[model samples]
Target: MVTLGVDGLVSGLDTTSIITNLMSVEAQPQTLLKSQLSATQAKATAYRTVNTRFDAIRSAAEALTSTSLAAARSASSTNSTVTASATSSAVDGSSVSFRVEQLATAKQVTSLEKWSSPTARADEQPKPVWPIKVLDSTGATVGSIVIPANATLTDAVSAINASGYGVHATIVQLAANQFRLQVSSDGTGTDGARTLQGADETADDPQSQTVGTAESGFQRSRDAVNAQISIDGTGYVRESSTNTFADLMTGVSVTVSKADPTATSPTTISVGVDGSAIAAKVKALVDAANGALGVIKGYTVSTAGSAVATLQGDRALVQLGDSVMDAVSSAIGGKSLSTLGLQLNKDGTLSFDSGKFTATLASDPTTVNRLLSGVPATTTDGVTTAAVPGFADKIAALAKAASNSSTGTLVQLANGRDTLANAIQDKIDGWDIRLANRKDTLTKQFTALETALSTIKNQASWLSSQINQLYNPNKSS
Candidate 1:
């Protein structure tokens, strides 16, 4: 029969194994929670990075707004030179003139190559001529024309205009019946190729004309105004085109050319912040941020295909997502993005009412600028104030808010998470400590039980031997 000690030994071993396994099951949640918290922190960091880029681009755009450049034109008659004066609000408002010895000019052609052959419909009578394509110095097709055999210059102009390939045909009457064909460009940029084909009724068959580019009046030369500048009462000599004048003045681009031999004309082309472009850039950034925010706000578990396993309904995630929206909405300037004419759409995109925005800017540029720079926390004198009132202040606040260090939300989340993690860690630590102790205790109990069992068994053996010897009679002595 089994002894009590043996039965106890079997029970202790089974209990130890079961308890250890139960402890592991209880610790599972803490491990998973730590990972979730880490993911939340990562998402926050990504949002902050995108937010920072938006702020940077917006600031750059704003600074460029309202800046303007002015230029003065002058030309020298004696030297065929041109000069211009460039100035800006920030630069010294003083005018400086320089001598331009030469004006930028390009070669122009009085006539484009005529197409010896004309394309005719099948129903039309056969015309034994081919159309020619005209090219400029760069071998680009500037125009094309068709001519009947031995056609006069008068006939050529009429034919070119009728072709409708964009080149204008004009005949200059210099001498009696001495007509020169003039072909002008239809658009900007360098001229293109002029080619001839088919037969000229009176001459040899028309071969392709050698492509030639006429010189343009525009030249690459120094600005006559700054050709010589008295910098601190000293003169600086310059050559070439007025683009050099651009280098002298901040934000001024001058086209230098000869107005006449006696005067060098420098025209200062105004270069200012394209308000439209700046506004567009601002709208794009806001739109992008809104897209991301909208997606997060409307996140649905239905998209995940398993309602029971969805993270969309998680309270922690929802709270975190709301915080992200609040941060952005609160950071933007004025009453809201909507107040600035940026409206959100259902598909998570933003559209700017350009007409409304333009009207606001035109009516009060400064007010618009200030609105763009700040958040609307309150209203005063019929104007909404920003949550962060000034451009400089807004930038500083955003920087502070986005910091991942001790004072930032990231740090707070991390610390809070660490607190939760530490709690779980503490539990795990306690479990480890308990496990060690339990394991040690079980080892001792098992060892003690085994020793007792051995002793009992030995005692039983001795008792049985004595019983048998006594029962055998002669064997007992």
Candidate 2:
């Protein structure tokens, strides 16, 4: 019934220290569990790092398989007066010569009699007659504009713009008090020409009213004209409504900047393959593969005086590195990475030679394209047979298999490590609880022992005092 932890009070012994020492011996298994947990966590971290490198390589491989690489072309113009652009459909190494004769013109008209006051109040000005009819090139009515009775030249211009007949109207100031309403076609071409008719039908004498001519209100400035160009020679000429001629050449758009029909020389437009761009894409793939190789080597290789890497001797990581190297060394269409100027090093990494690759691309471009992008083969009966996959295709598949979240090798390994670490932590926690209970029980036992020892000592001291008194009976009363 003694209170707990009251140790060595009467017996003069360090019972608490003795109990702590015993518990420390019992905690050995818990310390081992903690060490195992730390190792498992480290392994998981290493796997995640490798997975990141795999993702980068996968992205690069995907880019190498794009269709744009096969259709890359560049076009250049010799003369500044002409510019051209080529698309994927353009034929490589093709050239064309052409001279721009004339540029398309838009129809523009200005007011013959300038309005005296441009900034005059709209309420005090006499507006032009309402319902100005708009006409096209064929003298057919297209639309009409109606202005308010007391509107200024600016107001009338705004009304004309809102008519929605493919005509734009603006008020141009000539002098301090001189202003005119200018109207022009919204497009360039003979078909885009516009004419305005403001004949006063409401007047009793309709013949006296005029509209489009200078006597009425507006005067013609420039008439719409078509564009003209001569191809190869002056005997063959082409005409268009706009300067941009897309039909003149297949997959090539020619934009004329100036008109010089009489010029002796014509602008030469040349379309050809863009070798530098294709080489850059190949370099990216090589770099990504090297990056993945470096990550794998960092974990697998060992150094003196340093702790072994977490992934050292790990079979999964070792196999992954081997697979990547094998893909590079394997042949596609009897052509390996060496043919493309990519060399496999002794350390399982890739080295790229830009100069050699560029030369190979220029000399045998078709073969290079076929090797990187595997060609499809068919049997004699026209039935599809086994198709050869490119090196990039093989690497992409390997990356996906190794990094997949659900069933990938690295992902599974990381998940297993996490599970084992959690289990070990649980065991460590259990040991903590058991040790605390043991310490409490030991403290209670020691407290009881101390109480009993104190009682026995008191009893012995009392008995000795009684015996002394008995022996000295008459010495002191």
TM-score of each: 0.43, 0.63
CA lDDT scores, all candidates in order: 0.45, 0.78
Highest lDDT scorer: 2
Candidate 2 CA-lDDT value = 0.78
For 32-131, candidate 1 gives per-residue lDDT tens digits of 6556655555444544443444344344333423231012112211223333333343143323444434443322245322322232121122222446
lDDT of 1 at 404: 35
Model 1 spans with C-alpha error above 4 angstroms: 1-246, 253-268, 291-341, 347-349, 352-371, 374-411, 473-477
Predicted candidate 2 versus true structure: per-residue lDDT over 1-477, tens digit per residue:
223555587898889787888888978898888999999898888888898888877877776663766677777899987888888788888888888889999988886666677655433422234567777766677887876766677777787788799799887888877777788988777777776766553212236653433115556788788888888754688777778878466688888879997788888899887777777877888888888788887887777899887778778888898898888788888887788887789867888888887788889986777666666666867777787777777888889888888988888888899999899999999999997888778777788788799899999999998998889867775
Query: What number of clashing residue pairs does each candidate have, in the order they appear?
Result: 66, 0
